[model samples]
Target: MRLKDPMKRLNAGLLIIAFVLSLFAGRLVQLQGIDSGKYEALAMDQRLRRIELPAVRGTITDASGRPLALTQEARGVFADPSLIDPAKRTEVAARLSSMLGLDVQKVLEAISTPDSRYVVLAHSVTPEKGRLVLSLGYRGIGVVPESRRSYPSDAVAANVVGFVNQAGDGGAGLEYAQNKLLKGVPGWQRVEISAGDGQHIPMGEGQTQEPVPGQGLRLHLDQDIQWEAQTALADAVKEFKAESGTVVVMTPDGRVLAMASVPTFDPNEYAKADSSELQNRVVQEAFEPGSTGKVITAGALLEEGLVTPESTFDVPDHLWKYDKKFKDSHEHETYKNITFGGILAKSSNVGTIMASENLPDDKLYNYLTAFGFGAETGVGLPGETRGLLHPPSTWSGTDRYPISFGQTVSVNSLQMASVYATIANGGVRVTPTLVAGTLDEDGAFTAAPAPASRRVISEATSHQLIRMLEGAVGREGTAPAAQIPGYRVAGKTGTAERYVEKAGGYKGYTASFAGMAPADDPQLVVQVVLQDPKKKYYGGDTAAPVFQKVMSFALKSRKVPPTGTVAPTLKMFAD
Candidate 1:
């Protein structure tokens, strides 16, 4: 089809324009059909944001519902350096520093970084400070809610309660042990942000998830007893001028009423505290138990039919056996012939050795294991030690005599307290527990498992030892200071020469007393240990007084009726 000259020129122009429009149509289809999802995702990424909502930490309380640890509401301030105006950077940094206690130059340096989207300005910021920062109306600054850990009891049970860091992580003690149960599941939200302003869109237009708050912990510790113990221990440590000290108060059932240690630091100021001050010495420090171990030896002898309470032995002031010389705490001409019960009452090393002369070292070692030595108490508290208990194979020829009197054995104060507790529990060893129960997320109180118990001694043998311990607290016994008015108290005194690490010789002394109250029907087992008391290194003089004070206070506070039974006067010697 041939066209006229003018018509052909018009048709060519129209054909060219039509081809260009067709190309544009094909390009649009390819872009929309092939890449629609990718473009949509990129757009959403620019405007929509997902933010994390922090969950509340659990509360820690004593058995009496007294709060020990709590989580207080707080805020965290963050910044988007990319959004910060360079011209007003100094002004913003100075304002933040003044309000949040941050250094101005650091803030300036942080916001000056190029293309930085997020920078944490301050964690654990107070609500007041957060409000002040928000009032400044800076586009780059953002405030998120946070929590600050607090200890209500101060340093009373500081070692147990422990302190959390700024990021809300548990660092030590129960807090660390129960961290999994104490920290809850966090929530999240997906919201759209306005392009002009960095504010989140309304909830109806966004997706939100709620947080699950953590469970609460209820410890078995008694508030009244813990306070009494802390005060008494602190005072004794100071007065004795000892390097350190510890006290463990427990019920006959193995429920820990109080666990206290000296050189404690307030958890509120944990950052400024020395690491050494945070140690829980009751579970951490091991020392030779000294003559207090005679109770074990005496019990073993009676249980194994080697000696009766009335059995008599000609005990010399100096005992030479297995190529080692052992002497009593003091030399006395009249102490030659001592009865089995008299040996414990007087804390006589030579007399105990003579009583245990028939018993083998393996038999003694087995008994010690039954009494809860050589293993951790399994109280579930963090940083607990198993202590040192040598096997019979590790003992030398000279070891049997020394170990029988507690010279060769090492034990922590908690283990020592448990020894008395076993006797008080009528020869049953109960597992010590700190947590009585846990509060559910719904605020329901759920009781934890009852502490496990196993028989460590026969009831008959336990009674025999109890009677023997009563004599030790009598006026004729070693720890006369351990007597409580109107109460038949029974305990053993431990005075061991401390071993020097570098010199490998005897240096200072560790004085300790462990016993239970109302000796006939025991209720509480209390142990007080003073390490290296300069003035008086004798357990009778140093630790017995502390035991009396703490036990007396505990008895009164707990309203335990005193046993009207008079403490028996045990025979010091028998013919």
Candidate 2:
């Protein structure tokens, strides 16, 4: 409203303009210098994309390098929820479900996660399907290279090789036991992406770290023998109407050539299998070895000079010891002056108890422990039970007598097999082993360390025991069915009262047989066990035949010829 000088007004306007420009300059300095890292991080967060590159899982191979469990090339379907149109998420999920065979709801839930930048919709998708998914060109949808676990042999060695879960973790068996060594290390990729479309920018700043592939496992298992043993065990289980069955084939030095369990599940479809079938019975399940356990007593007797193979015992039909009446497997007249060898050959409970009478309780327990009972065989398997063995201090008055005959003690099949293996190895107990070595990505093999070993009995005593065990497979012995043609077989039969937890007492019998071939100079040992057989439950009738079939195959496959020496006849009666 007042007339003013033009020059003054112009000067005042210039000063206001200078003040505004200074404020802007100060803000620029703060953003470019003081808060530069913070602002740059926010900007990069919007443009940078970090992707996970999955590591290729290892292969599980037999001793001959036959792949049992392997990993195959696959793809993982993922989504950027922020890039997807909110209104079209349902449609995208429906399309993805059809292409990937995924549940629409699950896919929808994954992609619809609030404020998620990346979401995994499915894993282990076939490459073809992944390409098909890419063909749709749906915004925010992508696929990354991945691996899928496969079992080419189906159910063969399933219990030992184990299966992988959908999340790519080991579910059981050696897979679970050695997962860290097998899974290896994962990697990653970082790249700049377009903010508008989320597509990786060409020639943009990018970095990739290659994944380290998992180390492969080479086992002592022979796939052929594994398949044979599995088939044979399954057949035996079905034929005998037994609840389950297990078999273990090992070298005298404790290399597990074949370990099989019946009712095994296919690792490919492990999701559909019952949890019970996933266990490896050879190492996980434990039961009384019965007369098969008598070898320990025999070792104790001979090692301590308590008795010789010719030591006589008047084995009665029944004997009362600490309020428990022990009887032979079958009705028989009193064995007048039966030799110690005859007691084991016949698998006589009363005779075994009588033979162990002079042996101290602590000494018997020591022999059992030394033979690897009540402890794991160190076979490198997961969930291996030590089995149940009470010390002499914990033994009840009757416990000593029953345990002397293998009644109170419990042992897994692998441990029982090692017993005969130890005896076969001239009394040295070699720790059982399944894995032969580990293989690198380039196929270089690193052999595992040698298994631990210790002397369990004198070499002379072992030879004598082997000779005595040969009588058990002879014509007059209990397990004639275990004999292989042209092979000098030696073994023991076991038929023990099976204790069932649900039944609260002994409900059925566990039939088992453990033997070594060419008894004159043992090379291989095999143990067979059947649980709760319906019809015939004798170890000689049911389990021995399996032992014969499996042992015969193993012997032939290994090219182990017979010793060509006839087994010397041992005295059954001293009189």
Best by lDDT: 2
Global lDDT of each candidate: 0.85, 0.90
Off by over 4 Å in 1: 1-40, 47-49, 103-109, 191-206, 500-506
| Candidate 2, number of clashes | 0
TM-score for predicted model 2 compared with the true structure: 0.92
Write model 1 residue lDDT over 345-367, tens digit each, in one string: 88888887778878988899999
Number of colliding residue pairs in each model: 0, 0
Pairs that collide, model 2: none
lDDT of 2 at 96: 92
Worst 10 residues of 1 by lDDT: 196-205
Error of 2 at 73 (Å): 1.7
Best by TM-score: 2
